[model samples]
Target: MRSSTRFERDAFGPVEIAADRYWGAQTQRALGVFDIGEERFPSCLIHAFGLQKMAAARANLRCGALDPVLAEPVVAAASELRDGRFDAHFPLTIWQTGSGTQTNMNANEVIANRANEMLGQPLGSKFPVHPNDHVNASQSSNDSFPTVMHLVTVLELEERLKPSLVLLQESLRERANAFANVLKIARTHLMDAVPMTMGQAFDTFARQVAHGFDRIDATMPRLLSLPQGGTAAGTGLNAPPGFDVFFCEEIRALTGRNFSPNPSKFEGMAAHDALVEVSGALNVIATSLIKMANDLRWLGSGPRCGLGELKIPDDGLTSSIMPGKRNPTIAEVLAQACMQVVGNHATITMANASGNFELNVAKPVLIANLLQSIRVLADASRVFAQRLVQDVEVNGAQLARNVENALLLVTALNPILGYDKVAQITAAALEQGVTPRAAALSLGLLDEATYDRVVDARTLAGRPGHRPEGFSERS
Candidate 1:
């Protein structure tokens, strides 16, 4: 018989795998049947799982269930995994793994095998401690998976999203300051209204992002409230007296994860309101991003045919067939990411409803979707800010041209010319191909110098009490 067959025959029951394969026949069949590519779950999630195992192993040591011989290796493996060292061991196909049992066992077997190797033992041999009894001593997937999800999400938010949000806010503030002096016609309901400074419009964008960041940060405290210490059924069955508190503390120490005992372990295991809150928060931020990106897209629409107020960098062709075409692809991506976040939130909501008394079987789906939302929001925020917003050039000439062309600037003149005369001058300016000032002068509504002084966009956009020299408020 082949060495692989002999090895399998000695170690396992009638089932066996070929010598060339590390996994058994079941894994081989799963690999073939699912044939899913190397696309495993996020590496961060896998790292989180490893961190949980390490934390649990350390907790077990504190509980007198594991010796340093075993605990040391677990901690080392976890540290390596967290630093992105062992990626090959994480390629378990997601489809064939019913109930994620294969994945759980895979993690166990990988860690055990690695620990054994560290102890100068052959691979595939359970050493001084077993993978299940010692390493996963007091935990179940019901507890561990969700805990990992929470840890990864919270860490990503703090480490990645928070900084990116600050950068975006800074970018917006810079734009607001740069455009502080430019004036543009304000529109309500897509119709012309009074005048406002371009600074105000940019400031509004900054305020929207700031509010989203605040809301996201505000939601962090809720996320820190975790579902740890809830063992199989939240009863802490088979767990030592102080295991919950001590384990949470150990987790905090090891992973820098500040987890607390679920106030009601029963409710915690039986439901996922925390995940719902997270999803809701992500949806809110995604909605904000949609609004902000759409605003940029519309504001930067056209140099010739559209709004043409701001110009965006040309990253890609807007249309494949249209000549000289460039579209707001980045903004479009933000819109799509926002839609995905909304859909992911809906998925989380549905998954949250799937829990029974003791456990929610839809955990995999919830974690998957929730992580999707986090990654898409984080990545899209970074790209939209860096690629599109930061380097974009403002079309000051076009802005001035449009402002000068706008008949709405004449609204201020309405106070001087009466509404009828202002409307007539507006029409004549359009028809006679002259400046509103020249048209007003032709019609004797006002002199050239006075019209110029009073119709000044900057003076009008100034504070209510402020005006240019020789210009007085009508009221």
Candidate 2:
């Protein structure tokens, strides 16, 4: 039954390989052992590994560890992988060996076979470019794998996630400035508290997102440090001199982002604290998004039922039974996405703590969650900003009515009418279900003219010695 299959061998012994593919025996063994999940290392990770392998081959050649004849084709093959040519070849799951040994070997075999093909040799020749002796020469899964992790994470943060956050922040800021004239009653404990401009409320959300940007910036210096020369257990053993430096140089060239070698390979290989720090920043961002999203839901709720202080775009989502109903589906999406990010952050934190003396047994999950957090936050921010923030319409008349009915405007009345009188008026209004202004007038706290000037929401929010629109203070 096994007679027709092609055989490949590793140091372990002979094995079967996919007939048309380039990967060798070790990758095949990993595929057979660990097919538990559908989650594969992303193509971004594969591309970074290619970049690393290509750079490693050149560094080995320069350091006199690999022959130039092998180096050329390896470089070519590695370049193709880096350029995303063989992304489909990286089929190993994220559920593989903790150090990502299987993924590393997968890269090695794919690059080797491809390199040998470029040299007019058969796929498994292992001649001009042996997967281990040449392409992975001077590196181990410990150094190479984590270096790729850092590369993809750093690039994604700068290229996509960070920029998306800034975009969302700017969009919120623009709306904040535009909404300054639109007044609303602020809520505390779900009750009307005081007068705050719509602009002020939007600005608060912008400030929260801006703070998240600052938090992430603080983690960059550590996140950009590569563990490339650490080799197996951080001992730089087989990795030749200049490998770390060259790897950093190559990284800078490819990404246009600055990176440096880890000062201690042992520290780099043994722990994943940098990624944990990133997850913490992402956790804060998730909370910020949750606040903003929930606030929008409250503001946009009930065109006829709840607390509809603002109008959101009816993105055509209708209740199954009620054809006229449009719900806050995008806000719900943001909330659900934020919850996922929070959960993933917890996973990453545990993964960070799960490391033993030498290496984190959960580096794969740690980076996986970290990257997921970045991408989800970035996406939610973009969608919320465009669909929700940009289109949000303040129900100014309703806000004004709520402000007039709120007993808390007694806060403004206190300084003018004295605390005892204002307190008496507030209790009287609440007990009688009367408006605070009416209660004050009935109690003879002030004449109608004085009450009008002193208790106006516009005056309370805008100026110290303010008058109504037509009042003459001198008269």
Candidate 3:
């Protein structure tokens, strides 16, 4: 090959970096801008992405698209990145480059650049393993990005979210068991109206969370499907034949994950339904989280001015100016975190629908949003279980007091004292500011022995005990 005289000379001088640890000016600038408060792009996501590329390269090699020597370094570099040894190579700022193109190029250059250094080749030289031709062989961001997204979502859901969700359900179940013996007033419209056990309320929450977990489980198979060997377009035109099948199989082996090739190349690269589906799964989770957290806030509301059934950890300062003040900050944070996930889902929903025939221009936003929902939900669920569910105490004394004072418990009397007499007793108790028991006794609705036995919280909450043959509990 002859050197091209048409090659532009003076393409500008070499770039300089002031920071010793940073990779490039673009990466450094990115680091400054998208500092939206996350400490780092999670190492798990990075590892999954690197492993994905390795799988693609290995597949390409098996198909005989590249020389063995070139494939060796590509595999080696990808393996290092997967194992977290090449952190500096992954230096693109989260905000730096749109389409994640800069970040993808950064990975290629760093891997190739490092491999060359190992081979005693001059830096910036692209020989033996060109970054684009060899390291990135038979793959493009078009396929690799979504493939990695699916892989990461599946990994996180299986490894992190599922276990924590089980624990959350168990926490609620335990609370339900503990509260089963405590009879309480069930309220509707914020007004007490009937008799129910605290156990039933807690049990309902546990069941709802379990349903959310089911939704996540249902969404996993779609996420495990990858689009990797499709290359620049969905046609797989640039990818060697057999590349897709081999890549999927190798990934399943390397990562111990069951991934399959997407059946429709055109569908895979044409749009990102996999991402949307997973996002929808996560949104379901966020919806559950919001419901659980809000219920906790309401149930734990007040010692003097609120429901005050359960206690929440005092993690925030309610008032800077007032002394001895605490707030339900953990629950508040959980709610806000769920809200953020909901917002991310909205963005993903829009992005998924916004794509053109060949590709969606909104990929960067899609990836960012998908990642945000995964991480936030994972962390928030763990925190909620540990801080709010596990550590908080139940105000059993308050529960008893509320149950005792509630006129609504008198509804149980309707079944025993007859509806008309029960109504009279409730009205009298309210007017006189006296106990329902006292009112019932005064009204001659029932004899003292019968009223005491049947109206007690234990009997009312349980199987609504049998009355002697002569007297009916149902009147």
- Candidate number of the best lDDT: 2
lDDT of 3 by residue, 373-433 (tens): 8777877877887777776667888887877777866777777667888889889999999
User: Global CA lDDT of candidate 3, please?
Assistant: 0.73
For residue 326, model 2's alpha carbon misses the true position, in angstroms, by: 0.6
Cα lDDT tens digits, model 2, 299-329, are 9888877777888887877989987988888
TM-score for each of the candidates: 0.84, 0.93, 0.85
**Weakest 10 consecutive residues, lDDT, candidate 2?**
466-475
Better of 1 and 2 by TM-score: 2
Ranking by lDDT: 2, 3, 1
**How far is 39's C-alpha from truth in model 1 (Å)?**
6.4
Please give the TM-score that candidate 2 achieves against the real structure. 0.93
| Residue ranges of candidate 1 with Cα displaced over 4 Å | 1-39, 93-102, 316-319, 410-456, 462-475
Model 2 segments beyond 4 Å from truth? 1-5, 462-475
- Cα RMSD of all models vs. native, in order, equals 5.9, 5.5, 7.1
- Give per-residue CA lDDT, model 1, range 170-226, as digits (tens): 777677777787777787898766677777777777776776766776766666765
lDDT of each: 0.72, 0.82, 0.73
